[model samples]
Target: MSNSTSETVSFFILGAYLNIGYLRYLYFMITAMLYIVIVVANTSLIVVICVNRSLHEPMYLFLCSLFVNELYGSTGLFPFLLVQILSDIHTVSAPLCFLQIFCLYTYGGVEFSNLAVMSYDRYLAICCPLQYNTRMTSHKALIFIILVWLYCFVKFLIPLSLNIRLTLCGNTINGLYCSNYLVVKLACSDTQVNNIYGVFATALSILVTVLPILFSYMRILRVCFSGSKQTRQKAVSTCTPHLVSLLNFSFGCSFEILQSRFDMSGVPCVLRIILSLYFLIIQPLMNPVMYGLQMSKLRNICKHVLCYKLLAGGRNTVTESCEI
Candidate 1:
């Protein structure tokens, strides 16, 4: 196709239930339920954190931020995906596709940045317990959250804006979601600038986010080794949830980056689709579940909320019966 034709054409999302055959309806039901579960789980955690006065420390605030990010990321992808699953055509307009890429990519960057902030919070609390309160004040924690989001926004927006000007070689996006890397692949022009920007952004993102977590954990590990049994147990209780979250997010992100940057034509189409959606689908669901089960404070708050909700539900039933 001609460059002009390709440039104006909208993208066909070639990965939508590509190998699912007649199970598209079943797939839609399963994903829709999964989406609801994600929504409820993340929302519940966010609400619990917000409502509890005792949970107002930096660590809980960071957990709240992480939950919010999960919800933000999932919302950007799942609604459009559900619609696409039911629709006969799996196409996205060029503008809409680019918009999804921008939103979802921003989500990815912010996720890491938030994790890094959480790691820093843990480091202060564990390794430097005496100064943790004064250093990790509420105001400072809020500033870090704001900066993490702002940095992610400007970082992802630059390349996405640059991408909008590229003349495309094709209109087919080979994956389920709109990936910045995959979109760049379709460009017909010399994408050297875009490629460079992507590399710089990726490297910087890892440095600013993942490296800190690794470093903070290293220090925490050292302290745990030297400290008494009580200290080690305290460290394990507090740090394990964050570590679990980081590992889960890292795994999902690795698969996503790998699939986006590399040629995965040899991979099975079904498996490729699963890998592509892993981060988008799994992280939101997993983070809250992990934290809920692992963190004592959050778990208690959740139990209390569940009990309150159940009591209210039962009261409504009894009141209805009395009126009848």
Candidate 2:
């Protein structure tokens, strides 16, 4: 075996610090709080959809899937990030590095795929309301969701396989987390194959996930333009959240991809860190809030649940006092 291949080297993640010392506690507390908010927001939406039988329909089911994807993406990043922010040294073992790469990539892929599927769901509902119920059955929706996740997971594995074999001489990852391109760039040997596969995978994933969203929205737009006033209002109400989510996610992904590929040496480290961590930090918190506040049914259900919890807490407090 090659010496570089066999030799163990610790990877220092130099992206977390801002050169001014003592911000670790500040960063740690802020990140921890953000993580908690993400967990709470996404979980609340998921639980609301799952518990409410009325939300068992295809649209809500797809929404539940999206919330789950947000949670997956956040968990892949925030916990490790919280720890790194608190620790004096930011380092990661090779295996854990690779695992994070897989997770974050999968999270990104599944996110786009879920949004695309949700777009399709919206298209069917608005464009073909009569056929929607028959075509978008629970079984079929489940199948589509499974296929989106499976396809993304399997496709990402190929690039990961190529990455794992390269002999890396360097151990410094430039960004906050284990980015696929950054990891591949650290190789001691030529990474032409990895680079090629990485581009191909990125293009294919974008094509498959984004194209559908665009197509679905275009069709919906056409239908809405031709339909009645009520139809237009309904379409706007239903589609607004999905469109907002798409825009947010796309913006974050674009910044991260650009950060990974381009020369960012001139950019401020603090700005770079924000761009790199944008999707991980913002999108998870954004999606649930967007949907919860915009979608009337979901908002009502969440309010109802919160009120019930408050009343239950009050009853428990009274019972405890009586027992005392």
Which runs in model 2 stand beyond 4 Å of their true positions? 1-16, 319-324
Write down the lDDT that model 1 would get. 0.84
Off by over 4 Å in 1: 1-6, 13-21
lDDT tens readout by residue for model 2, 250-270: 999899989998998999988
Instruction: Please count the clashing residue pairs in each candidate, in the order shown.
Output: 0, 0
Best-fitting candidate, scored by lDDT: 2
RMSD of each: 2.0, 2.5
Give all candidates' CA lDDT scores.
Answer: 0.84, 0.85
TM-score of each: 0.93, 0.93
Give the TM-score (vs. native) of candidate 2: 0.93
User: Residue 61 error for model 2, in Å?
Assistant: 1.3
Give lDDT: candidate 1, residue 7. 49
| Residue pairs clashing, model 1 | none
